[model samples]
Target: MAGWEVRPSDPGRARRRRMLGLLLVLCLPLAFYAGGLWQQYKAPAAVVGALPVTVQDEQLLAEVEELRQRLLVLSSAEKVSQQANEQSRLTIKLLEEQIYKQQQDLASYKGVLAPASRREGLRIRTFELQATDRPDYFRYKILLSRVGKGDTPLEGQLQVAIVGKQGDQDVTHELSALTVDVPEAAPTQSLAFAFKHFQAIPEADRFAELKVPEGFIPREIRVRAEVQGEKPLVRTFKWNKEE
Candidate 1:
């Protein structure tokens, strides 16, 4: 009942594998088609020119043939150059896709392996605060999971506060003040999320739409997750502009 109840499936990994499989399926036929085109022009121009011609048009035909030969050579060079460029593009694209997938794999693996087994109950994983592109806006993410049977859901109310400096002294502000408190609106602001195994706080609801005073600078973020009949789990993260 303890340890992993079900092996966590990486949906992103499955999608990447499917894409790579489709790419391989697509590339094989393309390669074969290119090879077939390359093989069709095997015979030399000298053989074609040596064929017997009518007596009156022989001199004119020879001049025409020379021009034809030059044009054919130029066309062949251009065709090969075009094909090489296309192949180069495909190769670059494949490499870039591969590198991206590898990076995703590394991140997923770390997420699974980095934390040691707790054997029972709930635990919070990574918590990150990211500054958004919009002025005075920031985003935060928290991942929660339970170890053991996972038959009973972990019920908890997650509360977050921004601890900043109003002047010389520190001040704390609840995250709910910046967002709507409702099931229909900003659920992540002050919602109780329940999960048997894990849950991610929703993306749209993850950001704190702060209205910090002009002079007050944010210094720390404190998150308190209180489970039923259990002591509140608290995590304090230092905030700074540079990071």
Candidate 2:
């Protein structure tokens, strides 16, 4: 039989191979752990830098809110100031109207009392038509003044007529015919007047409110004073509406 040749194994080489395999396994775990730590570190740097921007944004929002509140307050103040100015204007207008009325009254009284302004016979001092709240109604005022004639009171029958257009036709209406209902003490057919110096139409009431017929446009007013034992005094005035 032929003798077989024996091959010898190297223990050092086997040991070195085993040690290299163990090192590779350990290094894989260490590399994974280091990569996770690096990602965490890089992300935090960017996050930390953004903190200043967030603080600035909060400060800007606060400033905007403060400005909005200031604007609102200013707007409220301006509105109040406008209202006050409007009220002041209205007050001034009312005062001016009062002053004008007082001046007119003073002039009227002076005309009646002054000797140089005296007239001998019955005089139609003033005749005015004022608009009432109703569109088809009016308030009228007539003042009669007398001077130097007599201590005896003058008596008269006052007749008033209005000439106007009624639907393309000329129409005339007597004051008594258009007169509204009145108390028994008041005159019905015609206004009666008896006064020493001055007399106002509708002696009891300051003015009389007359209803104008529909479709009638007034143009002129005629007044006749039929005084006892004296010639009648007739006066005509163009119709003009006062305020």
Candidate 3:
């Protein structure tokens, strides 16, 4: 009859095995849920704690701030430039007005001192004839003395004439006329005259021709000066033989 017989399983061992298998099945879903929550809420803390922000990102933020500052500076400069231009225009306008006023004042002052009426101190002192390099032209120089005693300079026009003596008659002609700008209360002044091309009075014959009639010696010349709105000034002077 025979060799082996089958024994019955232990109750505790079987119960323990079933219980372990059931626990594994129930905990698997809970573990999976817990892992998802940790990834959502706590994963960033670990990463942030371990690593620092990148330099590139920091630089980008700095560049944006710098651009903002530059824009503000440019706006301020434009405002300043506009103000300066306005001030410059105003200053130029004021200067022009002042210059015009000064000119008007000068003109008025000149008029008050030299009114056209009294011709007291005007006189001619000397007469001179000289030659220039130009042919057929002579320069006449006249020295005058302002006889006016006023403090202001006198302004007047001098009328001159050249007289020639024929055998028995006197021929008078106008040589050259000039305006004398005598200063106020000045003692002596000079006047010059340039005769148009005249072959009769060339450089070689610098002397002016004077003809004395039968009774005259051609000794002296007469001069008269007239100021606007004033009487004329008259005088006579002898011509120097050596001149």
Candidate 4:
């Protein structure tokens, strides 16, 4: 008897198995590539979470913070400037009010001292003499007493003169343009005047005439005080020459 021959599997079934095997092989490589991409993407998150920040990144953050602080300082400065301006305005207003009050007080004093009799009893006193260098100028200070039998201070020009002998001729210097106002029934107040190069040089033998201008000088240094009208209260002084 001949050996029994086994029938081979179906051609379609064999082909299907071969195709399945090929598909499996191709899918394996694709899966491996996809896994590598996933790992590559996930590595950044893991590393960043675990690693410390770099010095450059920290410096950038610090710079940003510094800029923010500068902006804050600038804003604060602006506010301060605005506040200072407001304060200045208030200060100016206060000063203006004070000036107005002083002016009113001055006016009232003048009204009281406007009489001729008040001028006749005016009290005058010399106070100080300041001599300065370079320009050879002198400043004379005098006090005028405002306390008198009046409601206002006296208002008049104070005539001042300095006379000395230079060589042969007599030298005279006069300052008759100084006008003063004294408050009536008040304490003594000061007045000042400045003279430039008012001196006599006997050695040079030149009589340095420092006389006040003809029209400006008063022959009789007197107060033209206003009573019902106006009158003159004259006073005279003769200066002695100093060697």
lDDT of each: 0.66, 0.77, 0.52, 0.45
TM-score of each candidate structure, all chains considered together: 0.45, 0.52, 0.36, 0.29
List all candidate RMSDs to the true structure: 41.2, 8.9, 21.7, 16.0
Q: Candidate 2 has what TM-score?
A: 0.52
lDDT of 2 by residue, 28-137 (tens): 99999999999999999999999999999999999999999999999999999999998997686566545544544555466556685555767766666766557998
Report the error of model 2 at residue 49, Å. 47
- Candidate 4 lDDT, 1-77, residue by residue in tens: 48988888689998999999999999999999999999999999988975666766888999999999999999999
Q: Global lDDT for candidate 4?
A: 0.45
Instruction: Write one digit per residue (lDDT tens) for candidate 3, span 1-243.
Output: 488888997999999999999999999999999999989889889777656566667888999999999999999999999999878866764564455334433443443344457454544444554333443344454444443345545556666665556457775534432212324442233223222111111133123322223443344456676655767767665544422
lDDT of model 3, residue 75? 96
Ranking by TM-score: 2, 1, 3, 4
Candidate number that wins on TM-score, 1 or 4: 1
- Candidate 3 shows a clash count of 10
What's model 2's overall lDDT?
0.77
